[model samples]
Target: MAETFAPVQPDNRMAAMSIVAATCFIALSTLFAKMLTTDALGPALSPFQVSHGRFVFALLFFVVGVAVIRPRLTRPHWGLHLARTGCGWGGVTLMFAAVAFIPMADATALSFTSPVFTLIFAVVLLGETVGWVRWAAVAVALTGAAVLLRPTPESFQPAALLALGAAVAMGTENIWIKKLTRREGRLQILLVNNLVGVVIASAALLAVGWQSPTSAQWGALAGVGLSMATAQSFYINGMARADASFVAPFIYGTLVFAALYDAVIFGAVPDWVSWLGAAIIVAGALLLAWREGRKRPTRLHPVAGVVK
Candidate 1:
């Protein structure tokens, strides 16, 4: 029988710190990605080329890690893996495109809509029951997204749409991830995701002529890969060490970090309306996480039968 880990006592402080670190790394990754497509590199690289470089470097990192770790590899449910990979690749592509054209803060804020979409998918696809409160939370989140988007002909930007599309793809990918986690190791999932991303992005690059990146651009791409992988590691560690509810609230810190990066690096500050919308979205997500935490059965210690 596969050995199960003992239920870990929640470490709120460590979890909080880990999440903050994860958020910062994520912000750094976004900053690096945006740098690749901006005048900082002289002529901006194409979004596809940037995406290709990111996945290529990320895959190289994962391959080296895998060689060192030598994790057990299992082949189960390849179809679902492919589906999840497709959704994730699509999300990453759209997100990079959004970052190229939109403010980092806006793109990050809109990405939070993934959890709301995940809730909807859970209800419809997973046959999970969502009560009135959760529904209300979803509605509030959507309203916030609309407030940020502001959909006027003069105000609307297509990049905003791309961000939302990324959210939806990520949400669907999240559902698949939930299913896969029941049967796969973390490294296995990540390996497949990066591998597929590299393949898809490489194919896309072929269609659009690969642009040779300068030395500085190469450094930025390396940063993107390293930061992204480290961010995922930090986030997973944080969530594993603490309750999901506790860790989830801290995940919203990504928006704050992204906003700060936007201001400091890009000199673009979001307007008051955008800030308000971000607040609303964070509020709704917190509520949803709280409710979901309550719904989950508390794990009990084997000897004492006391909740851990």
Candidate 2:
């Protein structure tokens, strides 16, 4: 039998640090991306270029990290790696579009829907059982998204939909990563996942034709890559040492950074209603974390078809 880890006591304090590190990096990256898109690089820069720059940096970072850390890059599961790559690229493409249009906080808030999609996919695709409480938590989270989007208006921006697409892609990516980690080392998994992104983004850039990014623009693009690479590395290291359920709530804390970035960088404060919606979203994320924390850690699930 697999050694069942205790739910509350995780092995890696460093992992917690990684999660925190990712939050900070993501927040800063959001601000940089907003600046790059709005001020330095115009919307004409295209999602393809943005994604290409992001993956290129991430791939370089992962490769260098593996060289220094000496993590084995065994190709244990190419198929799973490919799935994660596709999902990651899709999520990035959609999110870049969303961020280009919507406020960062709003985009972040909408992205929370991923966990809900994950939970549902777990039940349907993985055949995992979920109780009423989990279901209730999912509903609360969806309701919060509804409030934020206010779908009643046709004038509602498509950025909201793009955000949802990103969330769905990310949710699928998460499920696959959880499965991949079961048989793969954290660094190795990251290497393959990032390489996939680099390849896909490269193809997109080629098809769209590459842009000559200015020094400042390159920095923003590099920031996207560096921040994303750092965040994933930290998050995986943290998860290795801690219960995912315990660490999941910290993921929501990214919103605090998002709010700060929006306020200080763009002076893009969310309205009262938006704030309320954000609160609900955070609350739902917390509930989901609490729910997962209460459960016993079982053997990690196997990788399958995409969840969302």
lDDT of 1 at 3: 32
| Model 2 spans > 4 angstroms off | 1-24, 41-44, 94-112, 126-129, 148-152, 155-166, 238-256, 288-308
Residue ranges of candidate 1 with Cα displaced over 4 Å: 1-24, 92-112, 141-166, 234-254, 269-271, 288-297, 300-308
Look at candidate 2 and tell me the lDDT of residue 18: 67
Instruction: Report the lDDT tens digits of candidate 2 across residue range 1-308.
Output: 23222221243345445666777777677666666656556444666777778778988998888789885445458898898788877887787688778875577567767766666666565565666656666576566666655544432477689988998897777667766765577878788887887788788888979767777788788988999888887777666654333344455446556766777767978787767766776686567556665666444223331222
Write the residue-wise lDDT of candidate 1 on 190-228 in tens digits.
777778888888899999997788999999989888888
Report lDDT (Cα) of residue 172, candidate 1: 84
- Model 1, residue 271: what's the lDDT? 93
Which lDDT value does model 1 have at 202? 84
What TM-score would each prediction reach against the true structure? Answer: 0.73, 0.74
- Which residue pairs in model 2 clash with each other? 15-238
